[model samples]
Target: MPKQNSIAITGAGIAGLSLAIRLRQTGHSVQIFEARPREASGEGAFLTLAPNGINALRALGLAERVSSLGIPTTGIEILNAAGRRLALLDEREAQRQAGAASITLRRADLLEALRQTASAQGVDIRYDHALIDIERKADGVTLRFGNGESAHAHWLAGCDGVWSRTRRLALPASPEPLYTGLTGTGGFLDCPHVPSSGGVLRLMFGESAFFGYIKAQEGPVFWFDSFTLDEETAIGRPDPAALAARTRAQHAGDAAPVRDIAAAVTSVPRAYPVFDMGHLPRWFDDRVVLLGDAAHAVSPHAGQGASMAIEDAVVLAACLTAYGAPSRAFRAYETLRRDRVEHIVRISRRRGAKKQAKGPVALFLRDLLLPLLLPFDAKTTQAVQRYRADLDPLVLPAA
Candidate 1:
């Protein structure tokens, strides 16, 4: 009876796409609805897939295939405004401690990989179906899309991203994402003078902002910067040029690479306010359950958002298969994931606070204290990367 029910997923991003594949593998009829057009993804951002992220995708048999999307990343080199190295968080050590290498690639590339995998697996994904409303029934849910289409499913998984309409509709009391008062933007560049970064990613604590860059041997140098943003400035979601200018001004005197990259990147990537929603008491109601950023949006400071969602997909699918119903499975999933995800959210918030550090005293204290804390932070990250979303056995509740 459990496998007999139809499953519907909202959002065709990593979370929904992965979940759809998992649910299909579990013998569930799954359909995914994505509000945006198929081409509306990738957004000029790049990401690093940590070992744990690779491990999570491995559970879905996707690790090896997606490896083609990015280059291997060996370590993170942390530096100050003066280009003085603070610490190099060695990924080799992390790999020894965890079990996989990190991959650095464009956010678009990863999505394309997942999208291809999902499609190849015969997952039913419908694009341009933006969810507008959902009607909850005892046995299932009726979803209304902006395209004037309505569909019903025995179970609904809301894998919609940070601005999830499903969360708002399904759980009215869920708090809005809390703005961390930080806005970030980044771009890619190909400069002849800039050498290949190989497996190293550079992170700089600049005088007025935070910057990071990852180079793909002879390819483009992907860079990003985050700085403090007041409510007024962040409201309009500053244009790319303005963001670029601001970033250039902030990092002009930091380091040669930072300055060079800033000067070369003419595209002022959109500087959107970074927000995290970590106050939800529950992630589901009856047949409707939230997943990924829809449930708990984590700041990019942790770099675990995608991994966490991928883990959630695998675990939740197992729970559903084990418990044979939505309520119990969702509750178990929540019980298993809430603390971990919320903790990551808190960590990301704190890490982001460091990027917004202002004043000479604050910068001095941060630079002074970060080295002492680097080892511990690296250890914690390695441990986090080793986490496997293994599920214990579950029995259906008695009728």
Candidate 2:
């Protein structure tokens, strides 16, 4: 364990809470500041937890809770517009290599698990407290929150969302998030028509859009359709039903599962344009640092956002534990994580391009060739999933 220090983490999302839990366990005092007033109770759409993420959670000792909520994958079946099986992913081989199966669950379930673990670990979570500013001195950092409160700590870490206040303060000249020419409109639907032994997750690629649905427990499965939008086409926050209708109109092809899923969604769908920014020159300045989406907000196309966040949380805590002092820990974190995170960010963009490709020829190639290429692709996937956080690495004492 490292020398104890009072640490303040902004954003009570997956990364922040996980870090808070880990830090407190290793004999550090941790406090989490969240903008939302209390934990989010909204039912989240579906999310897949890759083995690397599962390993991080296992390290945090919440693996059982996560597995309990998870619907295991026998395998992944990729189908075409006519529902013909195009490709199959050998989930068994993947699991054997990683030592754990990829698990899919409602996003809310994962967040609740993180929140409960963090709270149970004695991490003080202060909700409704937005981070406004930070003052980093030679010795420590002082953080000012929106609620007219301030806290001084030996170190501060930002696990805030994509639009991070900490990032703006740390790197004021960084470029804004760039849209990747695709808009993802996602939500859950109670469609019993989609067979659910909880067998295979379905993905359909077409000229105008890509539709995906995953089975979940308790009868509410989730689906997301990614559509290529022109610059003028607005993918803004609107009524879910209205957005579904608009999305249906955008795809003028032989859409079966796509149309059915859209019409089945009773709950409002949420639409967000996918965007990712390249790595900043630095993730830490003195006693302040960034983690998770705050550090690298990769596109969802990579299907590694949650996994990456969980990895970041565990690794950040590990670096701090290994280094002890704020300055040294922050530097080690940047050195170890910057390249990996930046590489994933770029990979995610490429994955999105493959999914958002237009025309029947492009669709046939993506839907057909990509699956056949899984043997090769699995190697890339394993490289991303096999990361091990160096929590117990050697450290030099404070000079």
Candidate 3:
């Protein structure tokens, strides 16, 4: 049997936990370090995992488990500010092609599932051990923690998020995450007046902002709003009540449903400023490499951030299994992922730009062009949704 590799993964997120699970399945010794406490680490809003992401989870024998916890999204309904339907992107055909339906669920649920699975698979996860420094040595890499502790491992994977400490310590020259000038706020509401769409995502392109909602079979309506802001106006965080008021005001004049949904938000809405990292020149240094959001933080407009991270975990593990040597496997992993992730990032940026459309002319052009352009958008969705990581044996013999 081949000698098992000792890998230290920074971040117990979807990427890190999934990577740990896959590595352990392949007989690797893996440990995870997370900055936040285990209980607090799972705090996040809901997200949609496309079919491609589902397929990646399937590789880990987790698709069925995740699907059970999420609502299966069948299609998307695009609407104008006046509640007029613009275009419908049906997922029936895409699901047929992809062999799975896209799913939307709370980010916390998915993280919890990954964490439990990782633990069951014998991954040693330590929370509240934020990585503070990384040093490459002759024999291995040393990881320093903020808790006045340190450890060494033969290989290190930076599955930490956008503001990754590993990325900073390992590749200081890498580009930082750029603020996209769009702020997102969302919350759940039980508005009986708002009819359920039976798992279809309803999205509206308003004059000054964007609104989206979907209904689970039994839960409250899931809704989100995004709008552009000037750098100067995007100062300190707004409290939940203030954010709710701002969101309601932004979409108040758009449509009845928009107003109704905004008013229906009973709980204080949480806010997040959107950010993304563009193409990175490199994703690794020696035995240390970056994964998922640490390597490419895609804008949320494309709704593939988590999916991309899941795909990265599967591909990275397969590469490591094929190559044995950390450097070679990391290079192959980057080669397989960079182009795909970069393309998604570009598409997300374009989508975000359209969502942040301002001025009468831009809004007019968007309303006019969206219907004609939706067919192409559907085609792109097919391509993205049908992606499958090729985890077959590499042509090169294993080292």
Candidate 4:
């Protein structure tokens, strides 16, 4: 029998939970620590899971479970602020290529699904145990939490998000997440007035702001808007009502459908500033490693953040299964993921720059060039959605 290695995972977000499930399946013992209470895990805005994300979930036997709970979007329509059609990118071909369709669901729902699956597999998840400090030892690593508890593991993986404490502790000189100068505000609307969009995601490039919405087959519409703001104005959080009002004012007279969606929002819209991390020289140190947003955080413009994290989890698990030493496994995992993640980060930043165009010339150039660039954009989507994780050989032994 092989020796069972115990691993500690920080941050019970998508990356951590997915890694826990994958590691357990690979015959490793896993423990997950979450800074936030378990109840707060399910609170967040909606996110799209592309075909690549679906493929990763399928590797864990979770594709169908998540698909049953999310709305499938088959296409996207790019429009001008005046509601004029710009271009349409149908995802049917991409879906066929990847063996799964794209889905959009609340962040909480996905996290809950991951949590339940991990818990069912006997992964210990400790909530409110925020990681504060770490001490590397010869045989393993010692972790200290904010609650004054300590634990040692053969290896530690940091799956924390953009503002990761683990990354800070592991790489004291690592770059901080950089603000993209854009703020996003969005919410659900029960009474959307747009024509049935055939379950296609609608993206409107407004004169001054960008708006996106999708109407589920039998549910309320999900919508969001993004616009550029100065660093001073974008630093502090804004009230939900005030944010909604600001969104409406920004998009007023641009597109009727967007306006209708904004007016229909009854819930106080949630707001967040977009941020992404630049490339780091290293992602691992000795027995400690970083995963997901802790290593590379792409702006939402790419729609691949969650998917990328899922990919990281599967690949890291496979590396651990293949290599006897934790350090070697961490090196292999970083080598496999760094280039791909960094490329996506660059692509996402470019997309975000276009969406946050402020000057009239910049907006005009974007509007004029976007339609002509649809073909290239379709190719980009294919590249992002067609990734498949090699997970067969790493599946856990039957109990």
lDDT (C-alpha, whole model) for all candidates = 0.82, 0.74, 0.85, 0.84
- Which candidate do you rate higher for lDDT, 2 or 4? 4
Q: Tell me, what's the RMSD of every candidate?
A: 3.4, 4.1, 3.1, 3.8
Q: Each model's TM-score, in the order given?
A: 0.94, 0.90, 0.95, 0.94
Lowest lDDT sum, 10 consecutive residues, model 2, at: 390-399
Q: Which ten residues in a row have the lowest lDDT in candidate 3?
A: 390-399
From the highest lDDT down, the ranking of the candidates is 3, 4, 1, 2
Give the higher-lDDT candidate: 1 or 2.
Answer: 1
lDDT of 4 by residue, 1-399 (tens): 112398999999999999999888978889999999978766667889998888888777899999887789899889888888888888898899888999988888899899899999999999999999988877788899999999888879999899999999999889999999888877677763456667699999887788998886658878888888776666666677777777777777776778877766544545677889987889998878999999998889989999989888998888887887888988888888887888889888988888867677877787789889878978977876777774442432121
Checking candidate 3 for backbone clashes, the offending pairs are: none
lDDT of 2 by residue, 1-399 (tens): 212488888998888988888887778888898887774533346778877778778778887789788787656766666667777676677676776778888788888888888888888888888888888765677889888998887778898878889889877876667778887777767777765736467777654577777775456666777777654454456677777676666544535666666666554546777778775777887767888888888888777888878877777777776677777878887776777778778878877877767677877677768766866766777777665443332222110
Pitting candidate 1 against candidate 3, the one with the higher lDDT is 3
Off by over 4 Å in 4: 1-4, 192-195, 232-235, 266-269, 390-399
Per-residue lDDT for 51 in model 3? Answer: 88
**Reference-based lDDT, residue 202, model 3:** 93
List clashing residue pairs in candidate 4: 81-254
**Candidate 3, superposed: residue stretches over 4 Å from native:** 1-4, 231-235, 266-269, 390-399
TM match of model 3 to true structure:
0.95
Model 1: residues >4 Å from true position, as ranges?
A: 1-3, 390-399
